[model samples]
Target: MKLYEMRDRQSFGFSAENPSGSKGGGTRGGDCEKLRPCIDIQPGETVTLCETQGPGMITHMWFTGYIGHSFILRAYWDGLEEPSVEAPVSAFFGCAYDENFADRDGNYPVLNSAMVLVAPGRGYNCYWEMPFHKSCKITMENRGAQAQTLFYMISGWHGAIPENSGYFHAAYRQEHPVQKGRSYTVIDGIKGKGCFVGLSLAAGMNGHNTCWVEGEAKMYLDGDRYPTMNYTGTEDYFGGAYAFGNDVYQHRYQTFSGLYTGLYAILGDTSDTYNHQKRFLLYRWHVKDPVYFDSDFRMVLDNLGWTGPRYDDYTTVAYWYLESPAPTPVKLPEDGEMVMK
Candidate 1:
């Protein structure tokens, strides 16, 4: 965030050609053309992209592939046993539902934000400053049944971190049908000091034909009985209102992406297949106004105003920063549990 302040650091990069990220990475083959630009990730395989001792920060990351939904991304900081960053590849880059309604030109959806960006035709990019004190390691796992080709780059600077710098973390959760009585917990059990940076949310109606986005967002900090911070409506939390720019039954679901808020993906809408089920992708980044907690933190979304056999499915990814690079207990959904019909 210190744009004007220059700091001493060593620049490094990791890619298929430079898997180790050494000084002369791309020259292993010496003057060879198209030398190891992509990697084939087989089923049930994990690839270690970066593993370096660091008092450093990851400035940027880029990945171009069709393995978002099938591939899992995990990052460990400060030599932790568990990863601080854990989510599906596409979901972490602001597209929770992998398949999006194509644009007018029949291309992929786009998400252009301050921290994450998804270019046309499946290019995923991130600009979050991930810092670690002792060490950092990032890995990608292909859990799908088929093989996937991936071209990626991880770049950063090795330097001294500020004492106040917090470590980056991400966790993914999903609720199909949202459960009649239970609300959707975006993230919970974070028992430490940190600030909630933002979240990516995807919703799909399971059966009902009525508008299903009347839920509201709530934030519970420091062991509160009720939420100290709450929003008027769920769409309002993501800077959208009146059912995400269109009535669910009548019009095409519009898409948008901004610096801090976005409704970027809409799948199988009236404009697409005209099904009763309406799926959406949305996000809101609290870059300017993060929800800080000193002791503990949790947040949830209320599934208000509905009583029927039909309900909505919700997929959420919570991004935040912790005080240091320590592992917290996190249970992620298994591959079988997240299969979209």
Candidate 2:
């Protein structure tokens, strides 16, 4: 169908105003009435955001309020016992580490991309189309020490799901001070057929080095011992070269956010801890160039630099789509392990 084309389909949405997503829902509320604008989740509590029968595609999602690692986000498709998607709320949207959210001056990071949009004031939005044949479920777990307020909306269209449509999945991984002389595994233990679509990399140099972006991205597909694909360097993989093309004006390495790739967040000696090191947040979406695999896949990045292997603190969120519902390989770490100071 072209723009302005017509099709027989029904639209629905879930939110605090209308938890059921029923037809003519939220009609009971009035202008500025704000009868039910949000929900609060206490510590150690899990809230089901959306749970409904599906033969539909989830088109968009918007979330705010305490939008960081304190909350865990998970999604299940086709009534699977295991969630196909799991990760911290922040990393799923390309924001990782505590210092990357904002500075003392209140300058929020911005990422204008084809799949995600992170606006000021902690607005986290995703445009990934998640299709389910039988049912779909999305939940949030508050792992923080205090209660958290969540404002959200899940919207989509009811239609016939294609037989070959893949289910979306995302997982988070964090390693403080990567092992010396060893590469950090971005993602592994991937089984079945799917395409790796997006990646979020948050890094801080634990040891001295000219830069931490010297690592090379390697991908092993279909049980290959060696990598079949490689990104020359970390910067090159993010569409930058020679330390992200130095910005003479600011007297620092340039940072930018484009449609599919970006170095969006930068923290310089402002962290509560790790003050001696600098941290950077970057993202890449394989929207135009997806990594398709039939059997299995794995991706790793070497922590190398000018001198030699440079151990660093690294974290990431890997996103993909598979033909069937499957849980991510990486398990969510404990709260103490996920925190970044």
Candidate 3:
């Protein structure tokens, strides 16, 4: 069963022959200006971008100064609207290069950083690999400065599938901007363990803080389902560890033995005033356990031997299990390729 691909923007509409319709079907076409390298997904396989040509893999996506843009990759399983899994593209995880602030209306300062430029000729490219069974749709929207022009160069694999149950891992280089206050980024919060990892520079005790908030990523057990977990920490104890703050103040111990979801980052207090590019990086991991603090899990930070901010470039791997058998097998195209019509 190969995934369906519709080239014509109008093909997204409803047709008796095509029940599922097209991507963003019945919605405003203007919302998504279909670019090139459109792809179809296969169940349980990996997609490699370097194997193909054209904009199939994204090299660079540029937004005009002060304008806000969002790129969403959605997966549809069994006619569902929202993707079973989704991740946003931004500077928080260091996948982006430049960062600048904007007012409520999304306008930027006059001396803002230059636009992200796509390499000349044909070297621009980006790749997305997957390890689950799903149908995917990638959408990029310019929500701010409607008239601004955006340029995105992509080159890579198209709709390849992964053989396991993991998601795509993204890494990139980023150039920090010289702003008056500290900048923050959100790294991964889509239905997994609520743990988050963050990195930041030190300025003073005033501008140092780290936290993990929980609202989503709850899993079902045999008879009991656990609620979300929230934890916060600062540089106060053992340099920095974990703490608690929110509606209630209580110690919530967790085990990573089951499914989890959450986001993590380091935040600095600029209101009280702190100067200096404090380079610090941290990671937050959240897990749900029936037994609070019984299980012992060690947190290890491996230095892959890179320069710059210690947290600038790092990889996070997690381990969990599902008691049930594997998910249903997804159909693949007859030609052993994604179907793009």
Candidate 4:
């Protein structure tokens, strides 16, 4: 893997030709190197290396947070010159939060009432993939006074999908208003076998008190009816977890004769720890049917040990024929098993 490292004040230039001399006449010559685009990242900004590509181009990103403050990352491609994708600065899946105010530890069963953003002084992570464009972005922010750290990894995939496919699906830990209560949300205008399947746990008070829950949410395969998931409080599933910072995983799937996109997340949350609210993580994979069933998929959290939660949060995994030539096949483990870093 060819990985590029970027930090504050660092600028990378992409151009067409050499900048030394021009070809024609006395008019100071046109610099052969036509400037592609200048990715100007501010003090706390992260961006992709390049946006435009022929096809089958995948971009990967990894980020580490400093102190406890929140940061934002963005990616842009297609219609606009500027990157349009944004995400938070912490190791969590969505939004960013304080690193102090008590519930910051990685081991907590329930989140603090304030961290849920139910009232003032609370916020959630934001991630988006622009419609009609090949771009993605993540942003993180801490609404409190404390500082926090965050890590992230991003990748772009270049593959051909079946024709007639017009929708994309994604999964992530939904930040709710309470620790033990059940919350349900509706995904608007989606059709197909799309769903959210994963485990929810209460990371209680700095890894002290913790609990577990399991459930799944789904929508239709065609662009027809909307999909929804109902979380029950009795199931012991609440809040979210931090997996591998904020990550992006996209795959192409097929339904009957139509094609669709599937995206899901297994995330961790620590918004209700004892020290302060900070960090979120995610683990994701793209695979086909039999291979997916034989895969060992698991979720792991850092700093805090597993609190005996038996909920397996694996979303719907299926197969879809591609419209373009198949790329190199990447083999996945029979059983989905992931190790914590």
lDDT of each: 0.81, 0.85, 0.24, 0.26
lDDT of 2 at 206: 74
Summed backbone clashes in each candidate are 0, 0, 45, 76
Order of candidates by lDDT, top first?
2, 1, 4, 3
1-341, model 2: which lDDT tens digit per residue? 49588866799999989888877887486677878889999999999988878799898999998887989999999989989899998889888874366643347878778788889887889998899988999999999999989999999988787889999999999889899899999999999999999799988767664666778999999998989888998888988887686423433566789889998877656443543767788999999999999999899988888678888889999999998999878888997678786
Ranking by TM-score: 2, 1, 4, 3
Q: Tens-digit lDDT track for model 3 on 250-283?
A: 4331211111222122232223244522122222
* lDDT (Cα) of model 3: 0.24
Error of 1 at 320 (Å): 0.8
**Looking at model 2, how many pairs of residues clash?**
0
Model 1 TM-score? 0.91
Task: Report the lDDT tens digits of candidate 4 across residue range 43-120.
Answer: 433333334432222223333344122343333333344322222332222222223322223222122221111112
Candidate with better lDDT, 3 vs 4: 4
- Give the residue spans of candidate 2 off by over 4 A: 98-100, 103-106, 246-251, 270-275
Error in Å for residue 114 of model 1: 1.0
Model 1, 9-114: lDDT tens digits are 8899999989998787664565646778989999999999988887898999999866467889999998788888988897888777675547433557788898
Off by over 4 Å in 3: 1-80, 84-88, 91-128, 132-135, 154-163, 166-341
For model 3 the TM-score comes to 0.30
For TM-score, candidate 3 versus 4, the one ahead is: 4
Top candidate, metric lDDT: 2
lDDT score for candidate 1 against the true structure? 0.81
